[model samples]
Target: MSPRFEPITGRYLNLTLLGRPHRLYIEEAGQGIPLLCLHTAGSDGRQYRGLLNDKRITDNYRVIVFDMPWHGKSSPPEGYQNEEYKLTSRGYIQMILEIAGALELDKPVVMGCSIGGRIVLYLAHQHAKRFRAIIGLESAAHVAPYYDVEWLHRPDVHGGEVSAGVVSGLIAPTAPDNHRWETLWHYLQSGPGIFKGDLHFYKVDGDIRGKIDEIDGRASNLYLLTGEYDYSCTSEGTLDIAKRTGAEAQIMKGLGHFPMSEDPQKFISYLLPVLEKIRGAA
Candidate 1:
């Protein structure tokens, strides 16, 4: 028997973000139009392993996923143990632009999930010219805070276990046990305060409902795909965004917040048509 290899390749890069030096990790594969993927809160680029490996997608698009600072294989800035980690909307947007610039990706189509999902709206509104298209998975303008952020980082509590347990219910019951656990593992593996930091941006500062109408994109240029079972970013909320922005939208069935990772095959079924549409318009 021969050892099988996946086409995925990863590398490290040193970049200056927010005027500070940091080391970031990135993975990529396939070739063609650039497709930059953003992971959900508390997770990393590994969530898109399915999309990265799927020849159906990779065959037509070059896929890229970079773990943000303080997440996955990426390391934080030079400061050691000074302040609490927090993700501000400006910083988040700046980081994405920095990464895209550093990679020298020319007007790539950007797709993001959860926090990644929410930010695309801002991207389309503020920098639509910079991207060929934007896709938001489990996207909504605002998600009502479901839990207290403080609990995830308190001294008495175990951050990883509690964080994983809290989000476990967000996954659809239909997800395979293997993938469900894998999704939880990302939460479990998250660094102390990192998940909380992501959520600070996700819950407190990442609301776009007031300016949803301001986001500029045609039906062919913007997309919102939310899992039916995702309570955090309900399909209802996503549909409302679509209604206002007049962007393409769909509610994926039998999937949850972490669609690409939770069930790759099922997620692809919903995604291929979107890819075809993007390709046609491109």
Candidate 2:
């Protein structure tokens, strides 16, 4: 297996969604129902940059990834709240529409991790008919108070750099030294704003757990992927969502929240079954 991923350049573009200018950067390859990949907080679509190398991924689906508003190449509008960045589930759904129009992609398979995963559930609840399938990798609807409170006040407890460093440690224990360093550096670069934004998003956003039934009301395929070690969301939490949404769930062994960075091959392997379902639906 090669560590290097060939660079894929799409027509650089922008769109206004959630009242922010969203800079869309894409690496499009293969052909089928598009799989729009969204990254967790502090990272951009580049997290999936290497996954394109996998023949299974590239041969079967058109993978599209972009920086969310206020993340990476995307910049936040002036006076924009972190809430704008951590958008309510509805905000995220609108974002998908905005991004799709910007890129001229029809409703595609929506795939996301962490907060991105949460977005998938929300979108499914609102417009299940639009998507062919929805995949949530390590997703959840709520955060534990103890952990949330601590992280909500993280900087005061660990100082800015240490807090960022702690997050970096969570990326990939098996990653190359430089990769780990870069991953940590990525969080620090996003800084305190993202943390505040994420917390605000969590606090203000509507819980889709109760509304998950709306998702199951449709024929869309729902799938959940999690690292066996991903402490961010528990198996129980994911299973609960799966059961409620009538979705299938899988937990990959020996991984954490950032599975794409931790183990892309395993990530894609588990994703293959779900992809087959999505392809069949199309």
Choose the strongest candidate by TM-score: 1
- What does candidate 2's lDDT look like per residue over 141-188, in tens digits? 765533443453354554345446546645546655654555555566
Weakest lDDT window of 10 consecutive positions for candidate 1: 214-223
Q: Model 2 residue 242 lDDT? A: 81
**Which candidate has the highest lDDT of all?**
1
The residue pairs found clashing in candidate 1 are none
lDDT of 1 by residue, 59-109 (tens): 999999999999999987887479789887899999999999999999999
lDDT of 2: 0.69
- Candidate 1, TM-score vs. the true structure? 0.97
Output the worst ten-in-a-row residue range by lDDT, candidate 2: 144-153
Could you tell me how far off, in angstroms, the CA of residue 12 lies in candidate 2 after the best superposition? 2.9
List the global CA lDDT of all models: 0.90, 0.69
TM-score of each: 0.97, 0.83
Candidate 2, residue 130: Cα displacement in angstroms equals 1.0
